[model samples]
Target: MKRIVFFLGKGGVGKTTSSAALSFYLSRNKKTTYWVSIDPAHNLSDIVHKDLHIKTQIDDFLFAEEVDVEGYLKNFLHETTNRMKEMYKYLQIVNLENMFDLLKHSPGMEEYALMYAMKEKIEENQDFEYIIVDTPPTGLMLKILSLPFSSKMWIEKLIRWRKRIISHRAAIANINPKKIDESLALTEEDDKVLKELGYQSEYVTFLIDLLSDKSKCKMVVVLNEDAMSLSESLKIKSGLNDLGLGLDFVILNKEGLGTVSNNIEKIFDLPTIRMPYLKNAMDTNTLANMGQRLAKIVE
Candidate 1:
């Protein structure tokens, strides 16, 4: 991907609006842009005055989607469970059907699903010049942002244990020739379990390297002039910092008669791209102007 920009902030802070504006701006510049909404709230349609459910072309250069997170999460679980069963028939005894229901509520399920949802989009839409994401609120965004590195660690450990198991099984088969080729792989090359883990390892590593690269990925926070939004933005920055990623810029989305206080720009210690309160966000003049301001960071 040429550039992937993520817009994140607290609820009601205009993350969707800022992201939509930037998408419009990029597309008008003739940069093929894929604007996706990962937030379960799914209000990107409200910005364009279009009822969007699937990937719909907004104009000549823009394609938009409101990801069905709930449905996608169910599919993600089903696909994951099926793959696991294929690799290990032993799991059949565990009542994977019931386990799937339980796994929905399991901790980190949403985060994992959201991470994979993003991965699917980025990998599938390689032809797009720019990929703009409107992320969920702060808490979930933080969890999702941290998942790649954490998942990589978990997979690495699993890979190590899998290799050890293969080595031990090979040793056992060598000791007793009668037990060789008993429907299980005795070598790393043939072990489906090891192969699966290796694939997951590589995928998560790709996410890690992609997000850590400033030239390709940009994390923009949208915030109003308020303590709560500012507080969340700070937490977002701290989380990104811990992950070896930085908040590239911020959009101070001003709405209504409220004038923006420049203190936010100083507080974040980064350039602020301001979006004036739009009386009619979908109006041609307003969007063109909004796109101009939001385009500063991307350009």
Candidate 2:
């Protein structure tokens, strides 16, 4: 029942529209749903025609929000720097504010911040029947999605090293009781660093399990009718496959195949959901109709 759907694709591929329509469909069916736009560009508010800059009730069961990705990123860095400073007293004289500025642009910062925000969201919002994520463009989103797996390995290694450090200290203390540093942990139980690494390992494991559980989580690729989009979509699939996660389906947004269906099926070897070109202006009714069409896939 972990209905978390991530709509991903190249930039300008209508990911927001596709995810929004699905939210409309599910909400109308009385399913408790949260439609979130994690894209930093913040198009969900304009697309949904509501002030979703804040989490807003769209209906009896649906909630919408355009996550402040930049704000969240800043807060994420602040908290991280603070924690590191506390753990390593040597950092106190190192001009943390300047370091914070540089770290803001550091590699993997956005992905880690977004992942942390997602962890917080999942932990806090447990009642929803669905949490539809409208992700950023392909490259960054792929990194964000696969972050837990990479983080798991790093945390595990850190834990092992911390344990060794604790064991070494205990051995030294045993040999010379007077030589022990009371400030340092001689046992694993008293080591805050080790305990933190353990918590991180456990959290990453939870994310890995959640992401690999296909029934609970689904990944959909949205694309245009061009060969470029299709090519990028394939890379997305390969990335997820590398992570041992399956791609549920492909949404050929602005499907232009006409009577020439099954091309997507042949390419992706998966079910293809077509959303035809929107000749008419976009509105709530159009989205609702599109959502209605998408409802069958969920059933």
Candidate 3:
């Protein structure tokens, strides 16, 4: 079985560093690990001191990659357009140049794009024993994490609408076939699209089950000693709980550097780990050390 782990926190809380460190530690321990950076503003390369835009093999057991969001988005849009054309014969003449532009501004487009990339990577990386993701900040990560449930709900509504359309089409055909435009008639492609949507929804549901399963998935929330970070972490914990996924643990980074207290354990009700503040710049050596600390908790 594949184990997938995520490191998420507020921006500037050292999530990338922690993720890289933990991945390094895991890989060193004979686990076939792949470290993935999914943040739009990626810093995994900088942390690992390697060019991992596509992927880089660190060793026989370790691989790393930073997803190119723009490249993935373009491919996603192209695939979507192709699917649309396949579903609608009239789409051959329709101009979608503006549709692509509109999608860039659409709400949740980035999150969906990120989710698509994640799903693809997970599917392609079945050979790896461990998959570790360095996610974006708290808010966006929440949206991406909730995609399985939200997308399933959306697909369910679409399926219902498609059934209604089919019913109306049957009624119109019985009344007068000429009254309904041939182009407006539901085609085999429409049914195919609905079937595809249902199929994808099932896959998403499986993903949700796997994620909520503690043995297969571990979600660690990284935070610092601050009220804002604490508040965000609380919200994240609540959100994951709502989705039936537990917040596995919390890592308090930069301990003893600030006046912020570590009384968060009482409120969050989860095991808390702490990393001391590193005065020097973080390189592979320091990261490995950090990873050693994280490794203890996971073990």
Best by lDDT: 1
Evaluated with TM-score, which candidate comes out highest? Answer: 1
lDDT by residue (tens digit), candidate 3, 134-251: 9999889999999988898888898888878877886887899887767664553556667777777876877677788788788898888888887888888998998888798889
lDDT sort, best first = 1, 2, 3
lDDT of each: 0.83, 0.82, 0.80
lDDT of 1 by residue, 156-265 (tens): 88989989988988898889967765878987999998888988888888788889889989999988877788788999988899999999898877743353465777
Which of the predicted structures, 1 or 3, would earn the higher TM-score when compared with the native? 1
Model 2 per-residue lDDT tens digits across residues 1-299:
45888899999888988988898878877899998887888788886678887789977778998888888998988877787666665445677667687888899898898888777776566678888889999999999889999999889888888889889889999999778756777888888788778878887887888788777788999988887788899999999999999788898888764443458899899988889888652576678778876664565
Runs in model 2 deviating more than 4 A are 90-99, 257-262
TM-score leaderboard ranking: 1, 2, 3
Question: Whole-model lDDT, candidate 1?
Answer: 0.83
lDDT of 2 at 143: 94
Which runs in model 3 stand beyond 4 Å of their true positions? 91-97, 180-190, 279-281, 296-298
Question: What is the alpha-carbon lDDT of model 2 when measured against the actual structure?
Answer: 0.82
Model 1: residues with Cα > 4 Å off, grouped in runs: 90-93, 177-181, 255-260
Worst 10 residues of 1 by lDDT: 255-264
